[model samples]
Target: MSSMSARRGSRIGRGMAWAILIAAVLVTVFPFYWMVRTALTPAGDLFADSHALWPHHPTLINFKRVLGMTSAERARAAGGSGAQINFLWYTLNSIIYSAVIAIAQTFFCAMAGYAFARLRFPFRDALFGILVAALMVPPIFTLLPNFTMVKNLGLMNTFFGLVAPSVLMTPFAVFFLRQFFLSIPKEVEEAAVLDGVGRWGAFWRIIVPMSRGPLITIGLTTTVWAWKDYLWPLLVGRGEHTRVLTVALGVFLQQSPNTQPDWTGLMAGSTLSVLPVLVLLIFLGKRLVQSLNFSGIK
Candidate 1:
């Protein structure tokens, strides 16, 4: 009877967990659903609640507008080229920026984490503690200073300005990586050292290969954050020459003199922007979860 009761309880718990997950997914996905719904609706009655759940006359016009494909159509074609946005350029810039940050962030964080975890150095704990304290300070607090520094370096309106401060060495990356490195067994390194491998060599050859899980997690995380970054890019990249996708998307929506938003095109751009992350999450989900668990985030 007790065994049966336990089985029943386990089943109940699993069911409840799934119920909660479904609810959370619905909450998270509903906004995107609504955005697409709005995008599909005809421009004439976009604000009408009666048609809010579903469009009266669903059309691809909005996507066409966002992609500049609708410019030839009577609905939006009359708008001169002067009004069109250079979304493709900004998107490429975003891709380049995020990719660079991910690579640099992963390598730097892993090396720093190895130092903290294995290498004996003076003031290591003190320096790490300082890094931890730095995390508590919100990034927004440093924006003005960052901007000033960028200006002083004459990096404003340049990719270097955006990449230099953020991509190179962030405190959070160090912290997360350090936590992961802690979970690695010291015996492996000791064995490698006994086998005549030097410290740096052991880390490069032995340690890093075993820690692919954690590195990929950190890389994905850094990529996602770098891609989503808007404020920093907006501040440093004023002209179209340096604008990333996020700021360009904002500009796209607000371009109409009447402040009229383009629902379809906006959703299309957003969906496109989100595609890479979604694909990444799908591919990395297992590794990410395992890494997080191994890194001590129970």
Candidate 2:
């Protein structure tokens, strides 16, 4: 009788779990479905079937037109270049900034987090407390001061302006890495120290290799943030020569046709923009989830 009751309860819980999983998947995927559907809709009928969630007659003209515009922008840029938008250069610039910040943040943030998590130091708790306090200050509050500092340093409209600000170890990255570092056993570090390895040496040769889970997590997080960053990149990268993909994308949308905006083209461009992040997530999803599990999410 007890075994029969346990089986009934297990079946009920399993049914509920499956239902919740399907609902979650639908909620998350509904937006992408809409984006693609809109991208395929005829510009003329965009408002006709307002509730339509699927494409009736998919078209390729939008893709051709968007690609053509993207190409023209590149050719014009290869020449002396004037005030017109240059998607290629801007895209290249965004990639460079994002890649650099990903590498820098991973390297520097890991080291800083290790020190904070393990090493003995004067005012360690107090210093970490200050850093935690910094997390409360909204990024908007720092924009003006950062802009002014950039201008004073003659870095306005330059790569330095875009990347230097992002290179700093953010509070979130430090906290993420610190949680993973704390999970590591201290005896391993002590063994390295007793074997004549210096602090930096052990960190480079031992700790880093062992901390791959959190490192990959932080790298992916930073890369995604850098790719989607718009406000700061727009302010510092205003010129056609330096505009990033987000800015270039906005400029393209602003010039769409009135009756039937280029749906296919917008979708193609957007799909391309999202491809990298999606691929990275697919490959690193396990590592990302592991870090989050250890970190205790806010």
Candidate 3:
């Protein structure tokens, strides 16, 4: 009788867990579903059925309109404002902006982390403590100072201005890599030193190879953050040559002919903007998860 009750309780617990998982997935996926559904929907039909699970008359016309493939008349007819978004150019800009920050930050932060973990410099602990404390300060507080410095250097409306503040490293990133570096055994470095390897050689040849997991993970995360960043880009990347996808979206939002915005075009643009990030996550997701787990263990 006791065994029967325990089995029943286990079943109940399993059912509850599945229910929670399903609910969480639905909550997470519903927004993406709605975005795609709205993008496929004719603007005229948007108000006709506000609670639709899918569009009745799905079309790719919105994509054409957003990509500037459709004629202005055709775009207007399809419920677009006909303001052409330089989608390809903006995408390239976003890629460049994100790539620079991710690659540079990862390399530099790893070095800083190695120094904090292994090197014996004066006031090292105090400096590291200050860095860790920086993680607690809101990023907004630093924005004005960063902007002023960039502007004073005549870097406004340039990619350099957009990426300079974050390209080197962030405190949390250094701290995270430092913790992971601390987990690596000192014997590994000692062996490399006994083989005539210097500090730089040991770091590059031994430590870096072993720390590939964390590096990849941090690189992916930093890329995503830079890609999605809007405010900083909007401020500094306002020129046609430097404008990123997020800023382009803001431009699209304001370019409507009428008071009502181009909902279809906006959604289409959003979908296009998100595709690259989705593909990146899909391919690197396993590594990211493994790295995170490894970092956690460390």
Candidate 4:
């Protein structure tokens, strides 16, 4: 009788776990579903009293206007006068900004992390502690200083200004990579040394290859952060020439002349903006999971 009760309790616990997981999935996915649904629904039908879960009248009008494929009259009606900023160009800028930051952060952070893990030098721990401490500092606090530094360097409105401050490395990336590097066995490096492999060669050929998972994780994270960043880019990248997707989306939201926000176009633009990051995660997410599992990062 006791064994049967134990089995029944286990089944109930498993059922509750599955129920919780399904609820969590719904909570997470519903927003994306709503965004896409709104994007598909014609602007006229969106506010109708009898709104359907699926779009009643599916239309590409919102996407067409956002993508600049619609007639000039239609574009003007939907996006207003300030919609002159090209959506595709803004997307391109985001891609460039995110890609450069990701590559630079991954390489530099890996080098810094390896040094902290393996190299001996004066004030090494102290310096690393400072770097780690920076993780606790709110990014908002540094905005003024970074803006001043960028202005002093005469990099405003340039791609360099957008990329320079953040592209090099980040505190979190360094800390994360350092932790991963610490988990590596020193015997591997010693064996490489015994085989006459110099430190640089060993790092490049062995350590980097072995650390691919962590590197990918850092790169993906940096890329996503850079892509979503709006404040810094908006501050420095003032002109359409340097505008990124997030800033452009904000601009789009405000482009409505009469203060009536173009909900349909906004939803369409949002859906488009989210696609690149989603595709990136879909492709690289497995590597991230593998890295976390391999590194015992749970």
Tell me the RMSD of model 4 versus the true structure. Answer: 2.7
Roughly what TM-score does model 4 have, to 2 decimal places?
Answer: 0.88
Better of 1 and 4 by TM-score: 4
Residue 49 in candidate 4, Cα distance off native in Å: 7.0
Ordering by lDDT: 3, 4, 1, 2
lDDT of each: 0.78, 0.74, 0.87, 0.84
Residue-wise lDDT of candidate 3 within 118-145, one digit each (tens)?
9889999999999999998898899988
Error of 1 at 52 (Å): 6.0
TM-score of 1: 0.81
Q: Cα RMSDs of all predictions?
A: 3.9, 5.2, 2.4, 2.7
lDDT of 1 by residue, 66-147 (tens): 5555444544543322366555667688889999999998998899988997789999999999999999989899888989
Off by over 4 Å in 2: 1-20, 40-59, 69-91, 121-123, 257-263, 294-298
Candidate 4, 1-298: lDDT as tens digits = 9999999999999999999999999999999988998888877776781357888778888888877777778766654453564677888899999999999889999999999999889999999999999999899999899999999999999999989888888998888888888989999887897798878888898999999878888887788789889999999996889989899888887776565677778888899899997887798777756655534442
Return the top candidate by lDDT. Answer: 3
Candidate 3 Cα outliers beyond 4 Å, as residue runs: 257-259, 291-298
By TM-score: ranked, best first: 3, 4, 1, 2
